[model samples]
Target: MPTAEEIRRRIIEHGLSIRDRVIATMPQRYSLMVEQIRSIARSYRGDFDTFLTNLSSIKGLDLLVIYTALLAVLSKHKSLSDEEILKIGDSFDRHIYDVFSASKARRALEEAGVEKEIANDVISGVVKALNLINNKYNSPYLWIAEQRRIERFENSVREVLFRNEGGNRVGRGVKLFLRLFIHDTNIPLAVRIAYTQENKKYILHGDMYTALVTLRSGAFEDVASITAERVKARVAKRLLCEAKEGGARCKDVVMRLESIRGLVRYVGKISGDPIVYERGAYDIGYRYCRDLKCEACPINDVCKRYTFIKLK
Candidate 1:
């Protein structure tokens, strides 16, 4: 696995000609923010639990104020350009104003005898913090959108497995296999050999090999029985085709597979079939191989699965 520093160095080395420094910094920045958010969420769990319990004790407007404050602090280091900041501020303002302008929220505030001055103060504080472009470098909305997209993709995978009657054990096994394979930074030599000869893409082979090993040990006993040469040839063919056809870009294939892995896991857990899980992976791999366009994969024609692929 590449260390954070190593990843950064690699990015700098490879991205010198990419023009947009922000684009190059995206992966690192996102990693940092995710780590920070996890830390913050863990630290404030007690507060969050209490807030949820005392929901009625706080006004809706007060909750919005707190949310905006958290967003400001969390996004302080995003280093957004002036235009990006303005767009975010505008989104927040419009969203908040629309909520407040609603009949239900307005009526509730009025019934509570809330002072307009207090509401104005809260909104103004949020707006001021949002407008401070210097400290606000991140795109919280984009992060949220990405999260939603991932969730939707996972749901689609689950639906497909459930509809197909794939067995539970196979699905579960495949899901686990996928998770292990997809996010690994190091590519295994065996997987690289298989992928390059068959699929044509240079994937992180280490991850794929680990996944195969796990599959053999766990659900795919038949696969375990298969000769190593046969397995290598099969995988290589699939990967080579995908690479040549532009279904799997060497740069982003790992990330795209990670998303697909998450979907596979979700479906496996829901459907309770190991074969379903394996089939899901094969379907994804094959679909990518057949369609040059990642977005328009042939699997969609028959399998009906949807997933978000991060575009460069």
Candidate 2:
């Protein structure tokens, strides 16, 4: 088995670009994107939880609905500015969030003083350009889920929402936004960790993987199981915890699955939490690995990807 010292060393070697000084363009771009997202989220000033908690309240979830709907539209396309999204929202139906159809977008654009032909062309151009940019960023759809996952997530979301609130307490806009945003297959593994595991800490995908690797580097079944024993152990552990005085319960709900991924990655890392692997990879890949900047890296000698291919 690897010693505690070895495991700690490996953990330290992880995220070389992030922890080390290897200033590059991609990381700088990601930094700016993060700053912009923080600026945007801070504008909300902590009211999202209230909107989420009270679906049918007097204020209705109008603001949250609008923002998330815009997110649904803008997520795949980053070049489109927040102002453009707001303008599109100005003409949006607020209810027609099912597909975020190009037709709907064109109509909205036309309403926003754009010529009809130009609106169609603009939407087409935006999608094409974003797809091209993403390919450059991380070889096309590095983080997005496959189509099958999307379908399953849509079904799962509908079932869970119906089961939880019986379809009455929740707002339709919330449901639509959730369906698009959480589309089962597309959800990140890190997000599922935070949700199903009910993890109290902000452990990124890499942290979870690091924990597993650290535990399983040697010895059979020392920390991993090849049977149903693991699930049972977790449940038993939880039950035992609940048996304690006052019992253990989730102290705070985690961030929404629908929140901005890049921002989450950036913010989580800055605060010394696990950042999502794919998002972090996107930053590291474009900034350093793609350029083969090992010489500039402080921990290059220990980095696992020291010999990784340098490609765009």
Candidate 3:
């Protein structure tokens, strides 16, 4: 079996490989979204209010605030795909302000064909998210751009995640939004990626979490079989922390996280547009781990699962 350190190296190496491949060829929906945001940013010419006004026009950004609140309550265990999440957001975009109650939102999502668990989870998350954002910033769009200090931005994200009841200050959705928002306005990739990495908390969801757990489990027995999302996230964070502390020159952790999340925005190497990897990476990773298809997995050789196969 590969040593834990070796496993860590392998994961980081594979993650970097995934990052390059995906960044080179971004997904259509995500690429389009970046383009659209950039187009608006270009038109606005650095007017904050106008940029925000047009930005909130996106359901994902607006819906995100509500969900961030929900994430505080439910935690950041995303069970939906990016497509599904965006579709649901679009459905509610027409009248999200008009419907504030869980019952109302749940019923609407159900009518729109969302599953019961998903509907319940989404509604539960947003109600508190809306309250928190409203009491503080009054609008989600403002919340994204309100804090000038990175610490303040990180704090709000933590507040949203912990349901504003107070707990460890760590968050993801807002940061993800901030990433896209800043990148759209032409923030340097190094700056944004640095912030994301410095912030220390990775943007995670179900598939990404699962893939990490599987990789970790295959290589390290200590963390193997961890199913709790929060616990799994901590383990994932620790791996990167160890790598960083060891002075490993592994590629950007944030980009690797984005690669797993199935979309990334980087200053394009050959073009003016940001490179965006399409959604489905997490799905593919999840499936490989879920089905135990270790032999055919792209990173199988680095994974301990391959070690098992070798012994057999």
Candidate 4:
């Protein structure tokens, strides 16, 4: 029966505790490295944004560096279980495969004389470059191997997405992918560190809502965004319908909406644009709970919200 404020407090406490645990478990050398990396990364936030916006201009070597940096930071985690490490590896492999595949597709289109129809010049360039690299290597086997690796990675991503847990799947996925990519021996250490820091900043501040909004607005070159109004309206409708079906009081539904509104406000303060954040938060919350009360239900017992009637 935690009040809304109490639940918020708990979330903050839990987040802080988790951050501390991650920091505590890091090796001394890694801890020092992370600090240095963070300082360098702080200076490049704007540059990073620009890079994301102009991802096509990024060379294969630059991409490789980003992957390496991410892996280095992930290596500092002392508590990652064997399975977890494997999972991370799988995710990273998938991300790499995706890049490779896109590059290959672009090449095929260009070879077929259809590059102009593709519209995305960056994608076209990447594909053409990948094709050139393949030709230079004189190894179709490499492209084949990349395709197989991407398939495996995609399966892992699907499993992570569908799992029924409130745990931070996206965060975990990002962390795992970063580590493997950065640690890859083929990539340079400096590039790996640089890319890892850039990704870390995105994860630390970017929530599902922010990601969706960015996608909708088409502001980001790589990732997509969604409209704030559409997201909020959808979530509000779902919550209201759920409450109505569950025989909950109108006042309770109103309170629930209010609680969601509060979350939106908080996210806005942290992320900028309260309206977009609020809509995104509501969408996430609704989707997280689906048709049932989650473990983190703020108004469970006293609220008398139930989809199924009890047999007294």
Candidate 5:
């Protein structure tokens, strides 16, 4: 097997290659999405109440926030496929299209095959968050606009996003939800700021966690050495700094690591952004590193298949 350092190098190379390729020739992947996001951001300057009353279109920003709240909660369950998640989202969307009803939201989620407790958790937590947004911040858009620091802003968003109707805490998906919410190109303006300033603080999602731990084994101080999410994220960021400083491909490596860390989004894909360009080379339709389709994986020769799972 290749050494861990070699494996890390290979991962970085493949990720950057795919990123560059997509940016160069796949305008269709992000161009339209970027433009649509720009239009949405430009068209809406009103506060949350007006946004709720005047905008009932599916494409409206309020709906996006609501949908993201729903999807982010559901996304915590790794077993659900993307199609299944979308189905659940659609069901909730239909029920609470113009107005949000907690009972209806829970029922729709349960009917769409979500577990009872999880459905309840999703609805209760999201409803509380939405209510807080309306009552305190006046609007989610305004909440975003008023923030100065990224960390404080993220914390504020997380506070509302984690709200539960019964005053109980929701599960550990709050940060994941925040990441997904801010990264969505539908709010390209926010993404531009967050990604540029704080991308280093992002934790690798579960999908890329295995690949990262595998590659880092025996090479350097392992991020798995810690269990705290903040500590682990700091370690991961430090590793990125070391890799960028020690390697010839500094900028490229950091960008690729960012891609793997769930900080970059291809038009339709999530998490597996580094390999979004893979197709004929792998002969597999779509492969995320977590899929462990090593036979078709471009980095298989160096990947160690090792895994550690204490990440948040």
Candidate 6:
């Protein structure tokens, strides 16, 4: 098992990685974007304490679409540009998918001069997959002790993709939905006690959830598999629960987030960033695993699964 120190280092490192990308265009205006969002949250509620009262009330489709698009791109061994995403959504919002087909979707992209074979990234594939999941389970409050129902939902996602000619990898799609819902704090507990017991030869296989926990845990030198790290998260979750962080959800939220820095100055306390593992796990896939090569990944040195990228 990896020590907590290693994991904490990785969390900071991954946070830095994301921070770098989100503000790459400016003169690297460095800030933990959370602090900024927190500031917005604070002022909106007239104070931090009041914000927690309406944490779930401030809702909209804007954050949902952005999050869903990220998941869609990471769902396969493919990537999508912002323009490609806009075209797909625009086509749909304009009802162009009324005659939806691979060719028709392809034509729309072709008309836009997208020369790549983007059937999966564009109209008929990932877009449709996302819409299906959204329509079937469009809950801002998605969660389950209903393992059978969740399993049925997962199976239906696969069935939808099979019929729509989307990528047939059910786990990837299911995990992506889980990531998003958990991210928005819909189902936090599932991610913890999260991975299956069976270990894969590589981290990305059956253990992607814990693999993420390991990777986001910047100091992940000692862990054997993602499963090991997940075990760690389960332990951490208990510590959090015992500590009573963020009330029942183990993460307090603010309708209006303020920046008081320490726990005392704020409106409420939260469990250390809700579902950081889920968000980070999918991020590793989206950012690194798609075009996976040892040279391209920053944590490549520590990931034992790959020995040589430039194999002759």
Top candidate when judged by TM-score against the true structure: 5
Give the 10-residue window scoring lowest on summed lDDT in candidate 3: 263-272
TM-score of each: 0.20, 0.29, 0.46, 0.27, 0.54, 0.36
Candidate 3 backbone overlaps, count = 6
Ranking by lDDT: 5, 3, 6, 2, 4, 1
lDDT of 5 by residue, 1-312 (tens): 565345445554554454221122212323343455545544553343433333333244555556556766655554345456556655765666555678888877887888898888777777877888889767654555345455665567556775431211233355434444243232433543333444334433323343244322322222233222333464466557656775343322121333333311121122232222111112211343445455667765655443222222
Clashing pairs in 3: 26-276, 26-277, 27-277, 27-278, 70-125, 72-161
Report the lDDT tens digits of candidate 3 across residue range 79-140.
Answer: 44445444544554444544356776676567656768866765666666667777887776
Worst lDDT run of 10 residues, candidate 5, spans 276-285
Worst 10 residues of 6 by lDDT: 260-269
lDDT of 1 by residue, 190-250 (tens): 1211122221221211223223212221221122223333433444554566668754543
Per residue, candidate 6 scores C-alpha lDDT tens digits across 165-279 of 3442445444444433222223221221222211110112123333433433333434445543443464456446647754354432111111111211110111133234333
Model 4 bad stretches (over 4 Å): 1-5, 16-61, 64-263, 266-288, 291-293, 296-312
Worst 10 contiguous positions by lDDT, candidate 2: 19-28
Candidate number of the best lDDT: 5
RMSD of 6: 16.4
Instruction: Give the Cα error of residue 78 in candidate 3, in Å.
Output: 7.8
lDDT of 1: 0.30
Backbone clash total, candidate 4: 18
Tell me the tens digit of each residue's lDDT in model 4 across 1-312. 433333333333333332222233333433444454344334443364432333333234333422222332233322243344344334444445334455453443344333344413434333443455356533322221122132243333223222222234434433333222221121112232334432122122233332332222222222122433444454456557666774353322112222233333333344422222333333433333234444453323222222221111
Task: Indicate the TM-score of model 6.
Answer: 0.36
TM-score head-to-head 4 vs 6, winner: 6
Cα shift from native, residue 206, model 3 (Å): 10
lDDT score of residue 72 within candidate 5: 60
